[model samples]
Target: MDFKVREVVPHGRNYALLRMMPVKGEMPEVEPGQFVQVEIPNSKSTYLRRPISINWADRREMWLLVRRAGAGTNALCDLPEGSRLSIILPLGRGFDLSVRGNVLLVGGGVGTAPLLMLGKRLVTLGVDVKFLLGARTTSDLLQLELFKQTGETRVTTEDGSMGHRGLVTDHPLLTDGEIDHIACCGPLPMMKAVAAIARSRGISCEVSLENMMACGIGACLCCVEDTVDAGNVCVCKEGPVFNIKRLKW
Candidate 1:
């Protein structure tokens, strides 16, 4: 599907939120947890199709919260309004909205983008969902108001500058056994921590990973992850999200 570059809203010093204007208002035909492979025009070799988390999608417009951390994102930031970009969207499987009990959603950095969308979907589906956004500093915590609009939102900054004064794992939710189901996306250590917490409580958990990919499809076989049953599975094809129990990590 074709997605038009509608508007770019700068988030922080390094991040910008992109709004995609859908042709015929047919946006959001995809799941909340899905993603789009976007290619900005005139991007040099350093810039190319980048995988952006599907922040939120609807019939008219879709938003992507992207951090200008690298050449690709930097090039994307230069795109002007009304500029058109090519996109292969709503691709890949999303989180399984299976049982709807109390759900714990944990996110770190840009990984939090998709989790926010997931939280919205769960809320719309009438599933109890709570979010815990974690970052090294307050400056790194983006989209506080957006996350607040979804459901219960909490933050944990490594520094005492904001929200909680330690790692998000320090949040009481992880230790209280209050989360019926756990879903996490973040740095490897953070996700691993959440996984361990879930394991200790015997609660099933799922994780969305940010792996390198040469091809968005499985042909390149670049984004492979070691799984319990399937020795290696493409993160883009098999999943960007995987059950904790089945993952080798």
Candidate 2:
């Protein structure tokens, strides 16, 4: 679907919240943890579209929390309202919403983008949802109140500028042994540590991978991830989200 930029709100210095609406048809069904490949307009250097997580989506609009990591992403962040951008959306499998349990959604840095929608969906399903967000400083903890509206929200900052003064794993909630399931998205190391903690507690866990992607479909084979069952599959197709057990990590 091609979506027109509706708004771009900046967060601190490096991040921007993008709001977009479909150019023609009604919005397609988008699942939390699924992503979109966005076409960067007027960029000579960026040939491939960037895969951005679907932060929040509805029938009328789509939200993307973009980090200005490169020239391609910077161009996207600078887009004006009404600029049309092509997007291949709601791609890849999302977190399982069926299980009834005390669930924790963990995110590090901009990885927190996907969890808001996941939390909102879980809330609607009458499932218990809690969020654990981590950042380097309090300034990096964007949209804390929004997550709190869905469930109990906690924060961890490396500099002791937020709720807790360490990693999300260092938070008391992770050691409580009450969490039945966990859905996490973040840097590889953070996700790995969270998955390990979940494994130690025998809790079911899923992690969304921030893999390098090109086609946003199975064809490119650019985002291949090795798994225990499947030899190597494209993250754009087989995942972006996977069970902790399925991963070789």
Worst 10 residues of 1 by lDDT: 40-49
- Per-residue lDDT tens digits for candidate 1, residues 1-249, read 677888988876788888888665577576756777888678666554788878888778888988887888887776788878788777677787884899999998878988877888899899999889899899888888878998898899998788988888898877784878988988989999999989999888998877887667778888889999979888887778888888976
lDDT, candidate 1, equals 0.83
Name every residue pair that clashes in candidate 1: none
TM-score of each: 0.95, 0.98
User: Largest TM-score belongs to which candidate?
Assistant: 2
Against the reference, the lDDT scores of all candidates come to 0.83, 0.91
* Alpha-carbon deviation at 173 in model 2, angstroms: 0.5
Clashing pairs in 2: none
Off by over 4 Å in 2: none
